[model samples]
Target: MAGRWKNDLNWSDTTPKAAWLNRRQIMAGIGAAAFGGIAGPALAGLGAVKSDFSTVEEPNPLDHITSYCNYYEFGTGKEDPARNAHMLNTDGWQVEIDGLVDKPGTWTMDDILAGTTLEERIYRFRCVEAWSMVIPWVGFELSDLLARVGVQSGAKYVAFETALRPDEMPGVRSPVIDWPYVEGLRLDEAMNPLTILATGLYDEPIPNQNGAPIRLVVPWKYGFKSIKSIVRISLTDKEPPTSWNKTNGREYGFYSNVNPTVDHPRWSQASERVIGGGILAKRKPTLLFNGYGEQVADLYDGMDLAKFY
Candidate 1:
């Protein structure tokens, strides 16, 4: 009901909630129609095709979303990053870091990769306002990287932002979300084991749309909290505002967790359509941390999930 999803070039005026909901329902019905028919296998086969994000045998659900993202900065559409990211210049990509740090310098992406080991840690990625995915992230633990940085005592917030290259990325030209997409996490949260500084995925170079240069992966928080295409990483004393929160305060939050009880302003945060999993497929019930809550529930400690979420 709030925050328009419309645009002049692609998206039309926001559809009436009833019609859109009905369309979605009818689509689900169509999928159900094939359930009893010989086409059932055909429909089921599509899930394996769309969800082919991980080469691992078990195929953790979290790895599927992180590996295949709708990050349009590198390009539009869900599959764009997986296909077009190889064209991005990641070899010489440099992350310009500033703020509360003793050693503030532009570090090349290669150097950062060399310092960190690429561990395939599967994490649950739950988006705000319901929707979830599993991604087998190929990267090192955030704790290991933060330990190397040696943060000062005053640091409390860790802010991340995407690089702005209008000539290369046409998405930056419009105010779809924000020019240099920003995201932040508390000092302790940024350094947690579940928090990852990913460099690659599916045994390939980091896709440009999915934060090719580098991206943060916070397991317990919403997808946006884990900013992508990060060109800057800073430690700050004050609470840093994120891109969506800055633009729409009521809709977005700095600590947006995947809480089914606490609904977002525009819609309920209970369920999520797992995109790229297939168009005819049904959106599964979103889990806390895309379903790995057991591994990260304690991070929220003495706080209220409803308020923070």
Candidate 2:
């Protein structure tokens, strides 16, 4: 896949970390010159690849990131998730992996974590609501997890389901959106390196409202595509149904990539407001593929984005 796409982005220009993280750093030494002629901020834990991770934007402040969220399970208000998500019990969480896979079973969160390594991925998060943020997520590539289950030849899409405990998640009772919140990705999108199965953020455990235990993080797509509090992942031959798309397919498509030119039915998507940029933060032009076109544009070659979207 590396050679499949043209390398247009300056991947070498990446942030640096401690000398102990990898051999490159060890060889460079603490006092050694930084690579790519770009000095990057130091990050702890398994550092991200300079080429794949964003080196430009700073992650949104933890408070802003946590306090402002759209977890409908808690409520519709932005602050609802942060305030009501605590009722969700994350301990002993088990995810059911089934449908068109070699290995299908119920696996605990501990099992999932033990099977993969965590990395710090700094990604640009664009919301369909025309808001954006930079988040540093800690997790392994989603491809790694799918590989563990062994994607079958017949599988064409990956479907996800959020926990649906109405008692714990009060918002499920409401009809604002479909209950047992669901989302999906084409097989190719699921296998993309940028797609992650995030477990934590800011080097700490994920908060309850932010999809604690585990969640899908597809930086290139709208934030809604990144489902939260995931409890199931299914591989299927048919295109899986998604929550927003079900409510009104005209507005939300199955492939909700970040395209500034493709305006949402209700509002313009050409520009997005930076989430944590204070009260007066001006709107910034939305980037194709959320500024990751060089890495993922090939996936949609020749397809009409406006139609798929």
Candidate 3:
């Protein structure tokens, strides 16, 4: 798998480790003062092998990557997650695995991470809102985890659900789309080698705002399809209902691939604004599958993306 794709990005493309550690230090200090000397656990550095799936482009700055986010569980604003995500307690996180599987039960984080090797994949992330960024994500393939639990023959699709604690997630208090946001993928898509359950960003434990502990990272799909703070994963025989698609099926499709030709109902998807690019930086033309067409286009062979999307 290492040589299946070209290796274009390297350590230089990532934010310096020193800078990331310095930022964490400042954040820890602030947390201590804000929570009566009780700071969050110190994040352990993750060691992962570089992957060929990474793009050649330089990644977005740590500031932009951490500050600008879309975890609606915290709030709808881009900065709200960073400001309010501390309340989310990932201390004893558990993901309930059920539906068509040989072994179905609530599994701890340790269970999810066992018997898997991590890799650093610097992938291009495209949001349905017509914005994009290059991020260095550390995780193993989603297939590994699925294999560990044993996917049953009857399972045709995989569904995911985010944690929904109103006490911790303030945004859930309001009627925003639906509580316990859900998303899904066909069995083949879920098993794709490119799909991963990210545990860290820039080699550090993923920040709360960016789906700490674990989150799905499917580079070819819109950011929303890559659900965050996942609490449940079900292998089902039927296609599962996705939160955004349920809210407005016309705009947010289940297959939400980054197709430049398919314009959003509210805006154009032909071009995207780079997150860390200067204000004057020109919006670049969007690419099909966020420029991962070579790797994922075959999955949609013989199907009309515009119709399916």
Candidate 4:
């Protein structure tokens, strides 16, 4: 089944597999030594075995995915994150898991990844701005981490917070959105298998501009819903504040699912531009659940996605 998707991919629409494979070994943390001297350079040949969890298309190149990003902590421009995110210090990074959990405290990145097994997922990343990219992310399911903390019975939602350091983060100084950007998801949504704690891309350690250390990846939702550079996670009974929604609720709703039928107040969501699809690339039809409804539709079975979105 997975092979069918890989074979059906429109090569012209994605990064070439052979070229991307050759550069895979360059990923920082998952080098040959890290994966027991895997012979190939590309992650696709190493431990990154193709899985049914991935999308049918090929992923965008690491260069495009890393160079173009929205890490407001660095700056507002599309090229800002790549240039300014370097100021961030990720060494010995730690995450504080608190609120309605059985075990709540600070856990170092090493500790969190110690026993976790990594897997590759080629997911479609759709930004709220109507641009998209296919990414090969490396990490474990978000549910696995949540299980480690032992969610309590009363917990209904999961809140996340990005690190705040005025000295390192220049964008925080501006009142653009808010400091220490926050995002949240329903407990069930967090537990969904499609949700993951992404640690790397292209099977290598994630770049600082691209949410180094750790970040959330909710494939079914818009890209912004997948917050980056996370430092805090909490289990709560109420919905936590999200940066965009807090800035303007009318434009960015709590559940920012990708719905072509429901257009954003500023523009239509009926179609989106593919980021790595080249200068002449045309907009493609946006899919329900980003073409992942079969895997995640049941989560919102009774609710009107248009209203919730």
Q: Pick the TM-score winner.
A: 3
Error of 1 at 297 (Å): 2.8
| Model 2 lDDT tens row, 208-233 | 98898899999999999999999999
Off by over 4 Å in 2: 1-51
Candidate 1 regions exceeding 4 Å error are 1-68, 74-87, 275-282
Off by over 4 Å in 4: 1-18, 21-49
lDDT of 1 by residue, 269-293 (tens): 7788765567787867766655556
Top-lDDT structure, candidate number? 3
Give me the displacement of residue 166 in model 1, in angstroms.
0.4
Which one wins by lDDT: 1 or 4?
A: 4
For 1-309, candidate 3 gives per-residue lDDT tens digits of 323455566768655565655576667767776877654454336777688787778887677788999999899999999999999999999999999999999999998887677788899999999999999888988888888789999999999999999999999988888888999999999998889999988877889999988999999999999999999999999999999999999999899999999889899999999887788999999999999999889999999999988
How many backbone overlaps does candidate 4 show?
1
Q: Which candidate order results from sorting by lDDT in descending order? A: 3, 4, 2, 1
- In the order shown, the candidates' Cα RMSDs to the true structure are 14.1, 8.2, 4.0, 5.4
Global Cα lDDT for candidate 4: 0.85
lDDT of 1 at 264: 89
lDDT of 4 at 238: 96
Q: TM-score, each model?
A: 0.72, 0.84, 0.90, 0.87
Clashing pairs in 1: 61-134, 62-134, 62-135, 63-134, 63-135, 63-136, 64-134, 64-135, 131-272, 211-229
Clashes of each: 10, 0, 0, 1
Q: If candidate 3 were superposed on the true structure by all CA atoms, what would the RMSD be? A: 4.0
